[model samples]
Target: MPRKLLILIADGMGDYPAQELDGRTPLQAARTPNMDAAAAQGTVGTCRTIPSGMPAGSDIANMAIMGYAPKRYHTGRGPIEAAAQGLDCAPSDLIYRLNLCTVSELSPSGLMLDHSGGHIQNEEALNLLQVLRTELDTDQVQIIPGFQYRHLLKHTDGVGTLEAGLDLVPPHDILNTPLAPALEVYARSPLLDSMIHRAHSILTSAWNQTQANAIWPWGQGPPLALPSFAHTFGLRGAVISAVDLIKGLGRAAGMDVLDVPGATGLVDTNYQGKVQAALNFLEHGDFVFVHLEGPDECGHAGDLDCKIQAIERFDEHIVGPVMLDLARMEGAVCMACDHLTPVGVRTHTTEPVPFCFLDSRQIQSGAHEGFSEAAAAAGDVHLEAGHLLLPYLLDRMQEADG
Candidate 1:
C-alpha cells in the first residue's frame, strides 16, 4: 500500500528572539507539548521557503511549501487569490489584492493604522465592498469581495494604459508607518491612485464605521497556472485553509480545496473543524495540506501574548488531534511554518523555518528537545530548497518500507 502524507502548516509560526520572552522566540516560549513531542520523536530541520530576491509574503512561502518552486511558478499574491475566487481573466488583464485598511489620512503623510481594518468581520467587509462595487465598478475595473478585510481589484486594462512596471507595497508591511512612500508608488498608476482615493471617500462618508476607511491595492499579476498536484506527486491531494491565497493555489494546482465553517484566518478560528476536515479528506486522499493562519495574524499585529496563545492553541487543537489520528495509519506527517513573521519586525522575513517530519511506520528518536529555530538548526537535516520538503518526506516513507 502507498503511504499517506499529512503536512500541517502553522503560518508564520517561526520568529526571531523576543526581548519580552527573555531572548527566546515565540515558538520557543510557547507551551507546545504536541510539537515538542513530534520533534523529539521525529526529524527536525530548517527549510528556506522564500527564494532569494523575492518578497517574503505568505503567497510565495506557501507555494514553496506546497511543493512548487515560487521562483518559477509565482506571479503575484493577487492572481493566486483570484484563482481562489474562480475569476476568469485575459492574459493582459491585471488582478490586485485590495485590502480594506485603516489609514490615518488620505495624504502622502498619512499613517497605516491597521492593515486588517481592526480585523473587520465578513458581513461588515462585504457591505463596504458592495458599496465600492456599486460606485466604482467601471468597464475596466471591478471590485471583488473576499473574507474579512481582504478583497480584490480586477483591472481589464483593455487599453493597455497601465504600465507593466507599476509596483505597490503590501499594507501589512507598513503597519504604524507613514503611508507616503506607498502612496508615491501608487501614483505610478493614475487609475489605481484615483480609485484608491475615491474608495476612501466612499467608505468613510457612506459607512459609520471608521475601522475600514480606505482601500489599498497591491500585489498585481496576471492569472496564475500550475501543474496538477496529482501529476507531479502521484497522489490525490487536498488543501484546508481559510486564507484565499492558499485556497487559490490549491485550485490552480487542481487540488481539492476544503473549506471549514467558522475557519476564520484569526485566533478565534475554528481549529477543531480544520482538523476534522483534514481527517475526512485523508480518508480517500493520499495527501492533505492543513494551514492555520492564527499565528501569522498575531505576528502581523505584533501582539506577543496573542502570538504565543495562537501557537499553543495550534499545538493543542490542530496538531495533537491530527497526530493522534494519523498514528494508527501507515503514513508520514510533517509540521512546519512557511516563514518567520517576527513580532519585533512585524513583517515576514526570508529566513529558513523549522520543520519536523515523522514516519509512523518507523519513528526514530530525534536529538532536539522541541520544535524551534535554534533547536532545528542544531539538528542534522536542512533543506536549502523548501520545495524539496515534500519529496524528502515521501522518500523517508519509501525508505521505511524498504
Candidate 2:
C-alpha cells in the first residue's frame, strides 16, 4: 500500500487563543494525547501559505499548501469552490464565491456596521440565491446557491478565465488582505452595476423584507485551475472546509470534500464525525484534508473563550486522533493554519503562522508540547506565510518516496 498523508487544516488555528488560558492555546491546552504522541514521532516545523510581500486569500493560501505557486498556477474562484462542493468545472464556465451581505446605505460607512447581514444561515442564503437566479433575465450568466455565505454565478462563455480580481475592501480588507481599490473601479463600470442590480432586484422581491433581504454579492470572478496537494505530493487528496474559498481551492485543484453534518461554521462545531471521517478516508486514500472553520469563526466573532475551545477541539479531537491513526497506518500527518485570525482584530492577520508535523518513522517519540504558535515562540521553528509549508510538505513526501 502507498504511504498515506493526513493534512489537518484548522481554519484560523494559531497560537494566540492559548494566551487566555495560562499561555496554552487550544492546541496546547487541550488533551491531545494522540496528536502530542504523533508530534513526538515526527518532525514538527512551520511553513508559509502566504509568502512575504504578497497579498493572500484562503484560496491562494491553500493552493500554496498543496504546492502550487500562485503566479504560475492561478485560476478563478468558481472552479476552486465547485471542487469542494463536489461540482467539477468543465473548464469553460467561470466560478465565483458569493456573499449574502446586506446592501445597506453607504451612509454610515463605518466598518463595524457595514457588514450588517453577518453569516446568514444556509436556508436563507439559498432562498435569496434562488430568487436572484430566476430574476436576472438579461445576462447570459446563471446564478446558483452554495453555502451560507457562498453561491455560484456561472457565465456560459467557455473558459473565460476570469481573474479572482477581488479588490482590497470589506471581506478582503475588512476581514483580511486589504491592498487594492478594485471595487471602486469595478463599481463605476456598468458591468458592476448590472451585477449588483440583478441581486438587488431579487432581494427587494415580494418575499424579502428590504432591510435585511437586500443581499449584496461580491468577489466576482471565474473558476480557477491551479495545481493541488495531490498533484504536488502524489497523494490522493480531499479538503474539508466551511470557507467556500478553501473548498473552492480544493475544487480547482481536483480534490473532493468530506461531508460533515451540523457544521454550523460557529464556535460550536461538529467534531466527532470530522475526526472519524478523516481516519476512515486515510485508511483508504493517501491524503485527507480536514478544514475546521470554527476557530476562524470564533476569531471573527471575537469570542476568546469560544476561540480557545475551537482550537481545543482540534488538539483534543481532530489532530490528536489523526496522529494516532497515522501511527497505526505508518503514515505522516501535518497541522497548520492558513492565516492568523487574531481575536484582537477579529480579522485575518498578515503575521506568519507556525506548522507542526508528525510521523512515526521520522521521530520515534510521536508527540511534543511546543510545536504550534502558542509554544512555537518557545519551540525551535518559526515559519512565515502559509505557502512555505508546501515546499517542506513536498520535501517530506519525496523523502518517503525515497
Candidate 3:
C-alpha cells in the first residue's frame, strides 16, 4: 500500500491573544472541530517557518514549508511570482512585486491608507495597469497586470545599477504609517521614484473613481531557480493556491500548479473548488499542498470576525472533508500555518506556528485538546527549523507504514 501526503496550509493563521476574542487567538476562538480531532488523535507542535533575520512574508515561510530552505534557495518575492506567471527573464533583469495602493496624499507626510487599494476589483485594476503600461512601457521598464491590486514591474536594465543594496519596504507593513520614509527609500532609485510619482499622477488624473491612486514596487530580485521537488523528495507533488507567490514557488520547484475557479485570495474565496482540486490532484500525486489565503488577508485587514470565519471555513469546508477521505486510505495529513499575522499588528510576524500531523494508519493518543497555539505548545514536538517539517512528516509516515 502506498501512503500519500497532504499538507493543508492556512496562511498567516497564527496570531497573538486578542481582546476581541477575550485574550484568545482566532484559532483558539474559532470552531475547529476537525483540527481539534487531528491534534487530539495525532501529534501537535510548533514550527518556526520564518528563519531568524528574514522578513516574515508568505514567500519565505511557504518556501520553507514546501521543504526548501529559504536562506539557501530564496531569491525574492518578485522572482518567485514571475516564475508563477511563466515570465521569462534574464539573470540580469530586475523583477519587482508591484502593488496598486491608496495613499492619503503624495507628499512626504501622507499616509498609506490602503496597501491593497481597498481591494480594487480585477477589471478596474487591469484597466489602470493597461493605462500605465501604455504610458510607462519602455525598453528598460515594463508594467504587468496581475490579480486585483497585485501587479509586477520589470526593469530590463537594472542589474548592476539598481539591484545593489536597495531597500524598498512592503506597503502592507506600513499600513496607516507616514509615507515619508518609504518615499525616501524609493527616491534612492531615481528610475523607481520617477515611475512611482508618474504613476500616481496618471492614476489620479485618469481613474478617480477607485481607491487605487498609486503604484508601489518592492521585493526585487533576479530570476529564481530551484531543484526539482520530485527529485529532492521522491514524491510527485502538486500545489493548489489562489495567489501567485505560492504557485510561483511550486512552479520553480517543478511541481504541478493547480488553479481553481473563483479562488479569490479573500474571505469569499471558493473553498469547495480548492478542496476538489486538492482531492483530484491526490488521485495521481503523491503529495498535495493546499494553501488558503483568506485568513492572511483578513489578518492584514485587522478583521477579527472575518479571520475567525475564515478559519472555521477552512476547517469545515477543506480540512474536515479532506481528512475524512484521507482517513479511509493509507495516507498522512499535516495542517499548519506559515506564520503569525496577528490582527493587532495587522502584518506578518516571525513566530513559531502551530501544526498537527496525523497518520491514518496509526492514530496516537495525544493529550492535546484542540489545534491552537497554546495547545500545540503544550504538546511534545517542536521543530525550530521549519524546512525540516516536510521531511519529518514523511519520515513519520514511512515509519508508520513499516
Candidate 4:
C-alpha cells in the first residue's frame, strides 16, 4: 500500500516556561487530550527547526519544515510574500513586507504603538491600501495588500543596489520602541523611504482611518526560486495556510497551496475548515502540510490566556479530528511547530521546539505525558536539522516494513 503523510504545524506553538503559570509554558497549561494520546502511543521529541543564527522567522523555519535547507534555498520574506501575491518582478526589483502599523504620531520619531494596528480587518486594510496606492505609489513603488495588516511594498524600478543586509527592523520586533532609528536606517533607500513618509502623511489625514496610521516596511530582498516538492520527494503535496509567507513557500515548492474559507491567520480563524481542507486534499495527494497561525499571533500580542486558549482550540478542533481520521490510514503523522514565539519577548526564539510523530501501524512508547516542550525534551529522538526530519517522517512506513 502507498503510504500517506500528514504534517500539522501549529505555528509558534512552542514557548519558554512562564512564572505566572508556575513555570509552565502555554502548551503545558493547555488541556490537549488528543495530542497527549498521540504522545502516549507514538514518538515525541524536540527538533531544532530554526537553524542556528537564523532570525527565527516563519519564512526560514517553514522552508526548513518543507525539506529545504535554509542555508541553500532560503531567501528573504519579501520575495516569498511576493510569490504569494502572484507578483512577478525582475531579478533587479526589490520587495519588502509592509505592515499597516499604528504609531503614536505620524512622524518618523513616533513610537510603534501596535505592529498589527489592532489586527486590522481585510476590508479596512484594502481601503487603506487603495488610498496609499493612489496618494503615494509611483512608477518606482507599489503597495499590494494581503490579509489584515500584512501587505507588500514592491520597488518596481529599483536601482538593484538595495542590499539584503539593511538594518531595517521588523515592526513587530520594535513594539513600544521609537521608530526614528529604524526609519533613518530604511531611509537610506531614498526612493523607497520617500514613498513611506508620503504614505504615512496621507494615512494620518484619512477620514475613515483605523488604528493603522503608518506603513512599516522591512524583509527586503531580491527574487527567489526553489525546486518543486514533488520533484524532490516524489509525492504530490499541498500546503494549507492563511498567511502569504507560507502560501508563497508552498507555491515556490510547487505544492497545491490549498485555501480554506475563513482562514484569517488569527485566533478567530476557521480551524474546522482548515482540517477539512487537509483531509479533502489527502484523498488525492500523498502529502499535506497544514499550518495554523493562531498561537503565534496570541504570543506576539503577549496575551498568555489567549495563547493557551488557542493551543487548546487547535488540539480540539484540528488535531483531534485529523488524528481520528488518520488512524485508519496506512501512513504516518507528524505534529510540530516551525519555531518558538516566546511570550516574554513577544518575538520568535531560536530554541528547539517539540515534535510528535505517530505511525499508524508502528506506534512507539515511553513518550512523556503530553506533547509540550518539556515532554519532547525528555524523549529520545532529536533532529538537529529541521529539513532532514521530513525524510525521516516520510520513510517511517518503509522502515517499519523493512
CA lDDT of every candidate: 0.88, 0.61, 0.90, 0.85
Q: What tens digits encode model 3's per-residue C-alpha lDDT throughout 76-150?
A: 888899999999899898889999999999779999988899999999899888889998889998987888988
- What TM-score does structure 2 among the candidates reach? 0.80
Candidates ranked by lDDT: 3, 1, 4, 2
RMSD of each: 1.4, 4.2, 1.1, 1.6
Each candidate structure's count of clashing pairs: 0, 34, 0, 0
Checking candidate 1 for backbone clashes, the offending pairs are none
Residue clash pairs of candidate 4: none
Between candidates 2 and 4, the TM-score winner: 4
Which candidate has the top score in TM-score? 3
Worst 10 residues of 3 by lDDT: 157-166
Which model, 2 or 3, shows the larger TM-score?
3
- Model 1, C-alpha of 259: deviation from truth (Å): 1.2
Q: Which stretches of candidate 1 lie above 4 Å from their native place?
A: 158-163
TM-score of each: 0.97, 0.80, 0.98, 0.96
Candidate 1 lDDT, 1-402, residue by residue in tens: 345788999999999998889999999999999989888888999998988899999999899988999999888889999999999889888888999999999897899988998899899899888888998999989988898998888989632455445668899999888888888878887888889998888877944474999999888888899999999989899999999999999999999999899998888889999988888888888999999999999999999999999999999998899789766667778999999998988889998999988777776675569888998898788899889888888888888888
Estimate the overall C-alpha local distance difference test score of candidate 1: 0.88
Q: Tens digits of per-residue lDDT for model 4 on 121-231?
A: 889999888888888777877887787899998877553565456866788788777777887786787865777778778877848559888888888887779998999
lDDT per residue, candidate 2, 164-233, as tens digits? 3444143433533221243454455455447755566666567774343443344444455565557566
Best by lDDT: 3
